[model samples]
Target: MESMNESNLTALAAFNHNEALTKIPTFLFLVLLTPFGIIGNAGVIYVYGCRLKKTNLQHFITLLAVFDIVCCLVAFPLKMVELWLPVMYPSGNLCKVQNSIICFTCVASALTLLIISVDRYKKVCRPTQSQMTLCHAKILFSVITVISLIYSVTAAFIYDRRSIPLDSDGYLVGYTCVMDFNSVVTQGYFLALFVVLVIVLGTMLVLYCLVWKEAKKHFMQSDLRYRHSENQEDGEDHTSPHKRNLHRTNRTVVLISLLFAISFVPSLLVSVLFAQFTHVQFSMTTRTIRELIYGTWALNSSMNPLVYGFCNENFRTEFQNLRIPFGCYGRYPAPKKNDIKSIAQV
Candidate 1:
């Protein structure tokens, strides 16, 4: 089994050797992406963690943001190092640790997003019967923590280097540490993780679609009610006080749904594609296409802030009032008293 795995890996390495270089561009883009991710996710953490009233949903979302931040921090730096330094510069243990951190954080982020979607669906579609209490939030947190730890440990144990070639010649290449993805345990772990991610994400997507439809139906009913009231007012000399409020709420729901779809769907699609296609021995053109698709996933992190600002009025106002640090390009207002309080809480 070990010999067969080594042969497969050798073939894969040879196959990938002639592909287009990815290190430089990917690194440069990651460097540009890191600050955006940090700022956007940090703001989300702040809003949900400190500014908003304490609730299970809010806490879960805050933790999701934190998970995203961790993902960016862990994965981006290692990616940069891999791009610039020699691929074998890192020791075996360091590589294992880095890979495990990346895997753990990325999985945690995905699971947390799933949790957020489910939480939102419940609150929006089944508010009265929703079981999302503080205790539920605690349980969710514990579950995610346990899952992340287990994933990290498994990854660490499963990743290692057995041998390296001495040179570019067919005879031998220099020894370098690399993950043994050919191992049954490693492959099986990845396959299981991908399966779980797909199932959870797909379920959440379905729930969100149902929630959206129901919300839209409720919005239409509210609209009809307002129109009826307006017609009666035209006939009887009366005005409807709740008409504007209903419209505002409807707009809010639509905007939030739109933001979620736009910011999240691309990343989900990329993840699915990568899971299915990464191991395929594609032509250069196809490989390029894959890279492009994967690159768009970074947009998800960058656009998160824009989505939040557009969907949430509070975030918009707070962002506009954010005080820029010295030497920054953009104008920003001083922090509000509430912002100060939130910061203090943090």
Candidate 2:
């Protein structure tokens, strides 16, 4: 009789109304965020990929937009469904699959950003380094995509569909997706993720600093020369095209990096905290804050197009001319007859 009672306890767990209620606002935020993110990333894709004649850098940005669109269109929507109406989620591997897609997009997006940083570093810091032509960009992009996919496989395989009973009778009344954080294999995966992020961000930061220092020195010298010249020609533009392009590209990269760091780093740190410290407990407020952080992170995708518009004059002009539901290519002003490669690397 005692053995049967122990088995029953293992099979059944009560669903908590209070916890579900606590998640209400998070679900609501996701509901409102999903549509905007989809539209924003879609606009970015169509504008950058189709309307503009893409440079190698533009091609990279377009790919980033594609990943962000996937996040908005598929990953987060599935997550929202899971949170809002979990009963609708079929049992078995479906939940794991859903998480895999979400995690994949996140990893891909980060890797894409890492690529962008490397591209910029090469262009700005070593102008004579062989330029990344469209072909090279394609190869690099493909390599990173494959790497990110491989990294994301752990997320797919780590989780299992679990059923918990809601009462003492051992009746399974609820199902969930669960991963064992305590398991060595799962923690290894988490460690890999944490370490990769740290390495990528650190390298990006170092490269950015070097680029910025070079740019600042160049600018200061230019200013000094201007000041020394008493009779400078009013119409003369002394700044070289190469330098101007470098400056503009650096500005864009820095802005995007700052935006990404601000939006995602907090949530990522919190996640690391939870994973590393099993004894740590979260209160209702802490969970709520976590949801808000995640929502803001999702909202980051919507904000990228705006960043492009704010930083790139050409993008703004082309976006202005975009026709709703019409496939008109915008006027991109490079020498290429059909595909205008941007002068500045993104």
Model 1: weakest 10-residue lDDT segment is 237-246
Taking the tens digit of each residue's C-alpha lDDT, what string does model 1 give over 229-339? 667644553323343333333343334334444534554466545555545656756555555544454554455555566545667666555544343313544456665
Flag clash pairs in model 2. 12-165, 13-165
Model 2 agreement with the true structure over 1-346: per-residue lDDT tens digits: 8886666545432233444555678788878777777776777677777765657667877887887777777767666766654332455566676667666766776777778888777766777878778888888888878887886678877876666455456553566565676778787877787777788778889989988987777676765565456444656666654456677788887777777777667766776676666555579887667656655666556577778877877676656655564444435333354223452333
**Considering every candidate listed, which one attains the maximal lDDT?**
2
Pick the TM-score winner. 2
lDDT at 341, model 2: 41
Cα lDDT of all candidates, in order? 0.59, 0.68
Cα lDDT, model 2, residue 83: 63
What lDDT score goes with residue 102 in model 1? 61
